[model samples]
Target chain A: MSILTALARLLIFPGILFAVPAAWFFLWVERKSVAMMQGRIGPPFMQPFFDFIKLLGKSTPQRTGVAGALMRAWPLIAVSTAAGAVGLLPVLPSSGGFQGDLILLLALLEVPSICIIAAGFTSRSIFGEIGSAREAVLSVSYNVVFLLAIISVAASQHTFRLEALAQAPATSLRWIGILAVLICLPAKLHLNPFSLPNAEQEIYSGPMVEFAGPELAMWELSHGLEWVAATGLVATLIAPQMAFWGLSALAFVALSFGIVLLLSALAAATARLAIDTTVRFYWQCTIIFAVLAVSSALLMRLRS
Target chain B: MNLWKRLMCYCRRRSPWLFHLNSGSCNGCDIEIVAALAPRYDAEQLGVRLEGSPRHADILCVTGPVTRNAVCAIKTVYGQVCGPKAVVAIGSCPATTNVFIDSRTLDGPLGKHIPVDVFVPGCPPRPDAIIEGVAKAAQILAERGDEVPEVITAAEVQA
Candidate 1:
């Protein structure tokens, strides 16, 4: 393929244009589902889109020097990196990804969390600092399981390419690895039970306490992109590949929406756990899932 | 560009995230404000969300009589919210200092501190009433000009 086609693939399909809108849709699904579960009427379908627009239209406060520049840059970095991760998703099986792209996707996916941490500290607010500290700790704790889960799945499939992973047959080991990944999603997305980093009641939006107007809008957009990228990864692995690109893309979106509903139920049903409790819970799951993943991969290798 | 501007105005009306501030209320108006956002009332259907931080809020809902102690805090919070914002004074206390009109500790009638766009009457207004007030404030926000309205208190009006 020429560089133009590659650019089209990266900048159009499964990229910023597609991912940003899908992110808004998924966010709406999450909110609407949670509201239904709680017996309340949620906002309209266009609520998230409207919110983004309203925020962009509002006037922002002035800031000076390095802190201001970094604050402005962090959300852009987050948005670009997350969109890149989503772009790397094997939504269409024949999209043509290179070898070891799974690792590149993982690295890209991790950039948002890093950006959030840096953004919090850069804001120089006490709540932002506290949020940054909590995010730092939680990122470390959950990534142990997150990394191991993806690695074990890769080991079972015997390939590090995302397209190959999507095309590979699902084994019991792969399912277990996927289960481990699901456990990490709540913490990563800042949903209930693992939402300590941005506990709005206690810390006042934590890292985002100081952000307003277009800057905050960028952060919100980046968050929505993260929803797309993370869930899209899980969806790609579990969704069955089809002979046609169109069918594969449809299945990919449908499965991702299903995961969003499942996650919304979990978020609505649970309460925020204490930071210590959340850390302990993730470590325990890591140990159990680690054993299952490692043992299952070893079994697969031994059988082969 | 005109269409874009109009669309923005439409969006501003549609989504109004609120930050609730209690200058010194008796908790009656506070409960009513909560009730407005509760399941039965569901202000969220109108895209009215209760935000935690002032910076993220488009509407500031001030409850209760402005007490002497809360005066500074209220000003600080009002300053934090981004522009193109609206203020809704909930309950009669914020509008006229209510029954505590003679209370020495109070420095209220919220309009004295910040410009208020909407006032919901009643000592402790009903949930429906509070929601209506918020919706009205959101409308004001959508059409509001870039300039924050100059606050003219009763004393100033009399003068």
Candidate 2:
């Protein structure tokens, strides 16, 4: 690919253009689905966009520059990295993806979380620090499961390239790896039971409590992007082969919505777990599921 | 309104995230606010979310008669809310000090300490009324924009 073509593909297609809208759609689905399950009529279709606009127009609290500038830029960094990950991932069988992009994606996924931690510490607020600490702990706990799940997929498919992963055969061992990915995802997404880091009741929204206006807008937008990227990652990992690109994309949307439904259902079904219990659950339940998945793949490989 | 103001009006009025504060209320008005937010009343349809932090909030929903002890915190909290914001005084107490007027320890009638843009008058206002109050506050915020004045400070109240 020529430089301009590659730049155009990266910048226009999967970069901000594709990632932003897809992220917003995921957020809309999340809100609408959660409200439906709760028997409420939810916000209008453009609510998230409206929120972003309002935040853009709203005034931010005064803080001195350079340090404040960098502190406030975390959300920007986060959303960009997430969108960049989406740009790297293949959405269809024939979609072009950069070589050895899997490792880059894995690194990109961690950037948002790291941003959260960094944003928390930079604020100099005790609650932000506490929230950051909890987030750090959660990250340590879930990283094992998340990495293992990814490794399972990589090992099962025999290549770390996303294009190959999408076209990879859907064997029984791969299904187990998919389950491993599914079970470990809630922590990454900051959904309920594992959503303690931002618990309003406990810590006043933790790190982002002090974020107002455009800062908070970016935070919300980043989470939205993370949802799209994470769900797309899962969809590409498990999607069945289709003859048409549109059919596969629809399948991806349906699969992501299914994931959202499961997410909200989990939110409704469980209370927030305490810090220790959350760690224990990841290490015990989530990790065990991941370990089982990897062992099954290994066991199958040995038999062959 | 021009295109820019119109857009801001739509966005600000449509998505009014609220931060609820109780200035020594009997918990009645607070409960009503919760009722308004719950699934049945579902103020969420209008995008009226109850946010945890004042920083992220566009509307401040103040309940009960402002008490002597709650004054400073109220001032601080109200100040913490970023601009293009409005305050909805829920229940009769914050409006006129209601039945608590004769109490020596009382410091309210909420307007003495801060600006109130809307008032929903009931001992404990209904969820519908509370929702309307918030919506009214949202409208006030949308139209007023950057021209909205600072909330009355504690020093000014003493003067």
Candidate 3:
């Protein structure tokens, strides 16, 4: 097969197909796993798909005083970015991974966060504004930790290529890199304990308060994909020795998703930390872990 | 197709989303509703989602007797919920206004505002009873048609 033909095949078919289902399944796993940890039977494995279908069929209510066109289009932008980020990650065996730079991939994930904040702010509702503010605070708190963790991984592996990071040796120092990655995982997934922005009890679903119908479904799909991408990054970094082909990626995805579920359950079983407390916890707690991991990586590099 | 519809009706009978409306209640029943979602009684496992908006909801779980001031809000919320909906009069207050029956501010015994599908009798019904009431409401929802019964009047019930 010609290189150009193979590249074209990779970009269009597997890249798009891999993202939608992977994202949906990851969401299902998170819900079921959290339910199991809490000692309850969670929603069915296909619940997210069913929910998206149902939401799509419902009426889309426009918020009073918001610019109609902007509100309608924001979710599309968010979902597109989320899907784009999936391409940047090495979830599928196909090629075209270089369509995104490392910084571009990170920015793609942030697009949804920005859209969430914008949606909330545009709604002209008090709850919407408060939710947007909380989301802003959360973004500020975690953005640095996420960047530092990613930088640590890049520095240790000596390449910004996600595939290269996955192929890097699993040395003792890699364990530290693993810890830094783990701390950033919940932040990226928007799971419990780290779920300050969209706290259902406090802000009535935060930025999602006014969202309904197909717009809500798109946002939900993006969220599901974000969960997949975050967990996939962790699995790829920690256990690259696992095969990267079809079912091997599936197995690694499942294992990583299970780990995230256990963590979410732990978060749910515990009471919510105050916003200030959460901010303090992420900055202080994550920084300590990241620094230790980086130091270990440096020591290993010198010894080698 | 017939069997599938019947099975869906059966599942809907067992599970109903309870859309709680405060309508000036003292929040006693609200706490009970929350208790129903906790681990011991977890209604979520049964497919009972406590949705925020009335439009997306299936069952209207009204708490407290209707105060004169809140009567309009209650009616508005009830109207907003789509068809095939059921009204559950949660707590004794909404059912009869209970201790507040004599208050000048009360226009209640919630049946005055909307059709009451199932009456859960308690000052604040236990979480188990709330679950049972929700199940009953779901059954009513599945069976509802264009020929919904006329609103039951207080005078007719007393007679």
Candidate 4:
């Protein structure tokens, strides 16, 4: 057997197992962090896992809907896609230059968001419709910044490979791009101030209102993975020096978990923004930062 | 795994799930409860989930002063819940009827209609306080007695 294939299988199994606990940990961290921000004690770090277990043990309510099958499929798709995205990440790369293809990573990252929207649509509840629409809007809104940042990263590295971007020498202008990425990170993770699509108060948990029992648990699991994957991406881009196979993997997980906690703190301290306000904030304020970061990267390249 | 269970216990301590019922109020406290869920208060981060149905909920959060029209619906919902339930009266109106106390159509001081475990005193309590109250309710639910309270009010039967 080829060494790469054997290694890939080994890595993928651990990666999938890591995903389950990572997601559970994120849920606990999100709660604790948000509580700290509000001057309140948050739930224990194991809360999400117990909640999932409890839900699994509980009986699922049968709902009358044509979208039942789709709803059932969505969470599975979301979690698997999120896992795939994690696999493609350069957590433990044998070589320095672009571990997994960047284009592939980006596409995989977008899958969970799309599946969430589909789950919402299948439910056919008003809240589900609202959630689906909001999720769609969020996807479109963030993609703009995501695409721009990806383009800038590729332009600087002269390749659309993650490892190459990592291997590229750190330039002062990369900070600007990183800043843009930072802003996009919270939105991608569905943290507050930017958490419109699943605003529980406004539309009864947006897309997840109708989901109960195991289905809800799956969505929750995927959410935790999303946090891990998103933060892992950021850590990789910024801290490329830590790219050794095992150590990089460990560092990537630790750093990403820390970021999720920080964002959770911010979410607890803040309030939800009006949908209109969030859209503008992402498009105008956030996009400006991204553009500036890319421009700076370009300037640095010219100087070199 | 044991560590996770402990952490979950801690999370449940901070972020309590709230099942909000509109027991015929002016929508003021309801709005405030919702405000607690918004980003400004963002209770969800602390693990405070808002449940639509009472059966799956740990805390039964009732708003309004208990209008005559809503008493029956409230009783029915309160009965539907399993043991280890907690009732949180979200406004002064429900606690003592506040300004709406004198209305002949009102039938409240919610405790008279249902066993209220926690009273979140406010014309409309601040979102943070509401979050605190729900946390208290969750604790109560965890320690509640095994016997379910029987329906005692005449108003409960008519509705």
Per-residue lDDT of candidate 1, residues B1-159 (tens digit):
488888988999899999999988899989998888889999899999899899999999899899999999999999999998888888888989989998999998888788888888887888988888877778778887456767642211100
Which candidate, 1 or 3, would have the higher TM-score against the true structure?
1
DockQ-sorted candidate list, best first: 1, 2, 3, 4
Global lDDT of each candidate: 0.87, 0.82, 0.71, 0.72
Clashing pairs in 2: none
Each prediction's total of clashing residue pairs, residues at least 3 apart in sequence or on different chains, is: 0, 0, 0, 18
A-chain TM-score of every model: 0.96, 0.92, 0.86, 0.90
**Model 3 alpha-carbon drift over 4 Å, by segment:** A1-24, A44-46, A62-66, A94-100, A242-244, A291-304, B1-17, B26-28, B52-58, B75-86, B114-126, B139-159
All DockQ scores: 0.86, 0.82, 0.24, 0.13
What is the RMSD, in Å, between candidate 1 and the native fold over all Cα?
2.8
- How high is the lDDT of residue A245 in model 1? 79
lDDT of 2: 0.82
TM-score of the second chain of model 1 compared to its true counterpart: 0.92
Considering only N, C-alpha and C atoms within 3 Å, which residue pairs clash in candidate 3?
none
Write model 2 residue lDDT over A3-49, tens digit each, in one string. 66456545755557777877777788778887887888898998999
Clashing residue pairs in candidate 1 (N, C-alpha, C atoms within 3 angstroms): none
Q: What does the interface RMSD come to for each candidate? A: 0.6, 0.8, 3.9, 5.7
Candidate 1 displacement at residue A186 in angstroms: 0.8
Whole-model lDDT, model 3: 0.71
Distance from true location, Cα of B2 in model 3, Å: 12
